[model samples]
Target: MDQNKPFVTEFLETYKRHPALWNAKSNVSKNKHLRNLGIEDLLKVCQEKFKDANTAFVKRKINNLRTVFRRELNKVLKSKTTGSSVNEIYIPTLWYYDLLSFTTEDESGRVGISSLDDDTELQFT
Candidate 1:
């Protein structure tokens, strides 16, 4: 087991719990008051692990991780369109892929179904 695995896992779990971090189209993510909570979450984790952690350092780290995740996810999604079969689709090799898969959920595409009304009609026997 890699020594850094635990650290990465911890941060990923933290990111998952904070919807403002990954669910870009979510109301919480878009809200000015809540959007930055992801950064705050990471800052807390970093400060606890490394006493010297600062906002700039944590922000940069989070951005880099997000960039990597986006790139990797794009590759996988692209493969689905280009590949002719399941065997040809790209499989993520990064250990963090599983942890980051939650980001693939498209929150923006979700829609609510409204109830429809039906007019009653009289029938003759």
Candidate 2:
């Protein structure tokens, strides 16, 4: 069995759920085509397509996907744990870029902001 099968399955499912991730037509056939690429290529495409889409909704969706990815990754790690020869884990760098681009903190640490919209003011929480 392919080791990355679970990760690939989860990624394709998530990719299909978001119409914004589609390259051209947002349809099942097109999405299947998109899923043919490797994980790294998929992340690169998503990063390029949604780079400037920094609205609150988009950010929230991306963050949600990140959370899902992390959870799935944990499952993978748990399954692969052994004496001392586990394979090194790897994720696309663009995934981090997409999630972290809107995050920022100041020295005061009072204000937490993660939206790119100009009208959406950063509030202290």
Candidate 3:
């Protein structure tokens, strides 16, 4: 853990090293028992380094991270269809944008992505 990095950045960096935390299409990521173990493993690291994290906090942070990443990805993906010029296209400015790219894959084997519209509800397992 680097002392100078922000907690979110460190969290994302640590999370990137664990595919079960982000790669939904993976078998390991799909198993509830394995996913909980992976989350617990991440919580341990956060507790050791940040000292203020708990299971609830870790879970919330993970959800928030994924939510934002999905939103940004959706923006970028949607921008391509709007026929915007290169300069007018939505470019993700989120620092963790690229780091969370693993989640951009369409795990359901669909050729197209449904929008993450404001009216749509996201179900977290």
lDDT per model vs. reference: 0.78, 0.46, 0.77
lDDT for 121 in candidate 1 is: 59
Model 3 misplaced regions, further than 4 Å:
1-5, 106-125
lDDT at position 8, candidate 2? 41
- Write the residue-wise lDDT of candidate 3 on 1-125 in tens digits: 24535666767777776677677677778778877777787798789766888888888988988898889878987998899889888989887788777666636365766678879888999
Report the lDDT tens digits of candidate 1 across residue range 8-100: 789889888888767877778787656567778877888777889887987787677778987888888899988558988888888898898
Q: Give the per-residue Cα lDDT of candidate 2 at 43.
A: 59
As for TM-score, the candidate ahead, 1 or 3, is 1
Better of 2 and 3 by lDDT: 3
- Number of the top-ranking candidate, with TM-score as the measure: 1
Give the candidate order by descending lDDT: 1, 3, 2
Pairs that collide, model 2: none
TM-score for each model: 0.74, 0.25, 0.69
* Prediction 3 TM-score vs. true: 0.69
Residue lDDT tens for model 2, 41-72: 44554455456533343445546765765565
The CA-based lDDT of model 1 is what?
0.78
Where is model 1 more than 4 Å wrong at Cα?
Answer: 107-125
